[model samples]
Structures are given as structure tokens and as C-alpha cells.
Target: MKAIQYRKFGGPEVLEYVGLPDPEPRAGEVLIETTAIGVNFPDVRERMGVYNRAETQVGGVTLPQVGGLQVVGRVLNAGTEAHDHLVGRKVMALMSKGAYAQRAVARADMLVELEDDTDDVVMASVPCQGVTAFLALQVCTVLRPGESVLVHGAAGGVGNLAVQIAKVLGAATVIGTASSDTRRAFVLSRGADHAIAYDSPHWPESVLSITNGKGVDVILETVGGDVFDENFACLGMLGRCVVIGSTRGPGKPLAPRQLMAKAQTLTGVYLPSFFQRPDLIQRGLRFLKDGIGQGLIRPRVAATLPLSRAADAHAMLERREAQGVIVLDPRY
Candidate 1:
């Protein structure tokens, strides 16, 4: 089998497309002939040696690592027990590592069966970003109908999905933040009632005016740093803020005293930790399936590049130049 392997942690240059022996499934795992690999922020962090949740508890990553985070493929074989029924089935799998290859092993329980009509590349984007966006609005905050919403970085993968989900949940006013005019338009097209530039000096003020000085009822914040500070300030009384990611750097301190004054709720959403709950994972999958079937949510594949171009994909993502969700086609 051929895959991209990284011997050391650094830039995209560390990734080398090379040949490797196909790995067999362990107990409760399935070996998949890869269809598509979902490219995500964690994959980039792993390549830079900065994503090490396992380092403190388990151990640092092993060398010559394969770094894709989500895998969509057909089950070639299932190891042990009831999993045998999974053979020959198409699946969307969530993995911690080793998906940037033609063949990868996936935990049997972590996968959801895909319908024959499902677009393999699109479903490939669902496990990671799709689920994160779904839970962020519905589960994390429990956004209510007639409530207002403010989504930061609303033109990116999770942001785009969050915009749609907010609308589906009946958010009365959905305001999205992007860095440029093109992205702002993209956000509005996806269902945001309004789109503003996050870089604007008075976005929070803008939101206040949009909501008729009442402020918003819920906020979706993924970008950190001062952006978090500004967005948190926009929350209405008794409003909630869901922190998804801090790619910009840890935002301003969350002072309880500050929260007490506004009666606002501050919460964080991390997919890896949340995925540990089997109930939540399965529920999220059901929501995704129903959403796609109803035409309520459609994961976009912004760019489809072959696995050999994984390095280029990483670079484009790092530069924030890619639109929608970027995926890797291993068969290419």
C-alpha cells in the first residue's frame, strides 16, 4: 500500500508519499480500502508536533506516522465477533491517526454505515467538521427558536455548517463573521441572515445594532485571541458562548466575575474529548444522517486533491486559502 509518511515533525515538507505494508485490523476493528481522507486542523497540528493529547497520558507519537484524522472507505475485512457483518460495507470512520493511505484500520464502533447514494467525498467531511458543527449549535448551546446567533470565522468548514444548523434550529437572527467580502457573501449564501468582517474594528458593536441593542442570544466562537474577547462581549444577558477551537491562540481570560455581571454562560466544545461518549457520537451521527436526507445540511468538498498532494493541501489550509471542506482522495 502507498501512503504519506512523516519521519519527523515539522512543515508539510516532512510528509513523504511512500510504500508501506497494509495493516491488518485488530480485535473490534475493520480494515478499509480507502475512498477519501478528511483533512482537518488537527492533522496540521500533528505534523508540527504540537497536537499531542496522547503525549501526556499515553506517549508521544511514533515516528514515520500517518496523519489523516477521518477516513471514509469500504470494509475489506472485519476482525472478530459481530464486526464480520461489516465486511464489504461502506463506512465513514473517525480515527485518531493513520488515515492518509490506501488502506487504514478503523474501530468498528466508531464507523457509521453509508448509503449507496452517499457521495463518498462529502460523507468523508462529515465525521469531523460536520459532527462538530452539529453538536456545537444543538447540543452544546441548545440554541432556541427566535434566539439570535453570532458565528465567528463563519466562512470556514465548521463555520459554514454552523450557519446552516443555526437556521435549521430557527435562530431569528444569524450573523456570521468572515475576513473578507467574498467569504462574507459565502456565509450569507449558506443561511446567515447577515455577514460581517471579524477584522472590523466594531463587529461587536455591529452585532449590538443588528439585535436592536439587546445583543445576541448565542455565540459560536472558534477563532481565539482578542476575537474571543470581542465576541464574548457581544453576548446578550443570559446568553451562551460555545468555544469550538482556539487556532489563533488562547483568548482572553474567562473571568467568573465578568460572567456574573452579565449572567452569560461560557462553554467550550472539543470534538476529541466529546467523542469519548458513545451516546453522543451515535446521536450526532443520526443527526447528520437525518440532516443530509432532509436537505438541511450539505457538507461541501471545496477542493479534491489526490493523496499525493497532501502536502499542498496542508499548505493551502495553513494559509487559510481553501474554501469549504478540503478532502484527499486516496485512490487518486
Candidate 2:
């Protein structure tokens, strides 16, 4: 088997494509021949060792790690008879590690079977970013029907999907904030009612104007730093703001009293924590699958490179060069 791994944390240059012995599954797990692997921002952060310094119990990857969260593949075998039924079936799986390879093992219960016609590269982009977007809206904050939503980093992998998923989940008006005209346009194409440039200092005013001064009812905030602070300027009474990620790094501290003024709520979402609740994980996967199946949500694949170019994929993500998700085709 061939895999990309990092023996030491650093830049994309640290990722090495090398040969390895085939991985075998343990009880309740299945071996999968990966067709496509999803490249995410966290993979970049992992390579840089950002998670290692985090004070929270989130996202620390060990040295010499394969460092990927999801893959779309076909089952090759199973460890136990209980999971034998999965053999030879196509699946989209979420894992804690080891997905950046030609083959990987995933918990049998963590996979969702897919049809032969399903696009592997696109589905490969779903498990991490798609589920985060879904949970930010549907679980973290419980976006109500007819409510307005403001999504930061609206052109990003998770952000783009969040824009579409908000509409599918019944948002009356979905407002997206991106850094450029091209990205803002892309956000609108994904079903956002309005697209504003978060790069502008007055962007919060634009959000207020869009809502006729009432402000949006929900906010999905991924870009941290000043953008996170600015979200409060347009958060409506009783609105919910769910922090999904901090791509720009953590924002300044907030006073709890600030939320008291509008009776608003603030929440944070870490996808790994939800893994403990298989029921919720399955629910999120089903929602994403159904949304795609019904044509309500579309997961975009910006580019597909051979697995050997995994370092290039990481570089693309680090530069924020991909408007949508990039995938790695291990078969190449």
C-alpha cells in the first residue's frame, strides 16, 4: 500500500508519499480500497502541529501520522463476520486517522454505503466539512425555519456547503460572507440570498441592511479573528451563533454580558466530539446523503490530484486557493 505521512510537523513539505504494508481491520472494522480521499484545512493544521498546542482536548495528531479524516471507497474485507456484509460494497467513511492512503481501515459502523453511480470524489469531501456544516446549523444551534443565516467564509469547503444546507434546511434568507468578488459570487450561486465581502470593515452593516435592521436569526461562524467579533453586530434578538472553526485563529475574548443584551446564544462545534454519539453521526450523514440525493445540496470538488500529490493538495488548502474541496485519487 502507498500512503502519505508526516514524521515531523511542519509545512506541506513534511508530507511524504511512501509505501507501507497493507492495513488489516480489527473487530467491528472493515478494510477499504480508497478511491478518493478528502483534503481538508485541518490536515494542514495537523501538519503544522497547531493542534498539539491547543489547551482544549481537541485535534492533536501523533507524529508519523497518516492524518486524514474521510474517504470514499469500496469495502475489501471485514474483521468480523458481523461486518462481512459490508465487503465489496462502496462506502463513504469517517475516521480519526489513516485516510491518506491507497487503502485504510474504518469502523464498520462509521460508514455509509453508497450507490455505484455516486461520485466518489465529491462524496469523499462530505464526511468532515459537510457534517460540520450540518451540525453547526442543525445541531449546534438548531436553525429554525424561516430564519435568516449569516455564514462566514461562505466560499470555503465547509462554508460553501453550509450555504446550500441552510437553504435545504429551510432558512428564509441565507447571507454569505466571502473575501472576494469571485468567492462572493460563488456563494450566491450556492443559494445564498445575499453575498457580502467580509473583507470590508462595514460588512456587519451590510448584514443589518439585508435583514432590514432586524439582523439575521442564525450565524454559522467559521472564520475566526475579527470576523467572529463582527458577527455580533448583526446577530438578532434570540439569535444563535455557532462557531464551527477558527481558520484565521481564535478571536479576542468576549464578555458574557454581551449575549445578555440581545438574549442571544453562542455555541461551538467540534466534529470529533460528535463521533461519540453514533446516532447523531448517522443522522448527519443521512441528512447529507438525502440532501445530495434530492438535489438540494451539492458538494463541489475543486480539483482531483493523484495521491502522490498530497503535498500539493495541502499547499492548495493552506493558500486558500480552492473555492471548493480538493480530492486525492489513490488509484492513480
Give the winner by lDDT. 2
In each prediction, how many residue pairs overlap at the backbone (N, C-alpha, C within less than 3 A)? 0, 0
Q: After superposition, how far is residue 187 of candidate 1 from its true place, in Å?
A: 0.4
Residue 130 of model 2 has an lDDT of 88
Task: Give each model a TM-score.
Answer: 0.93, 0.96
Candidate 2: list runs displaced more than 4 Å: 54-59
Highest-TM-score candidate: 2
- Root-mean-square deviation of each candidate, in angstroms? 2.2, 1.5
Q: What's model 1's overall lDDT? A: 0.85
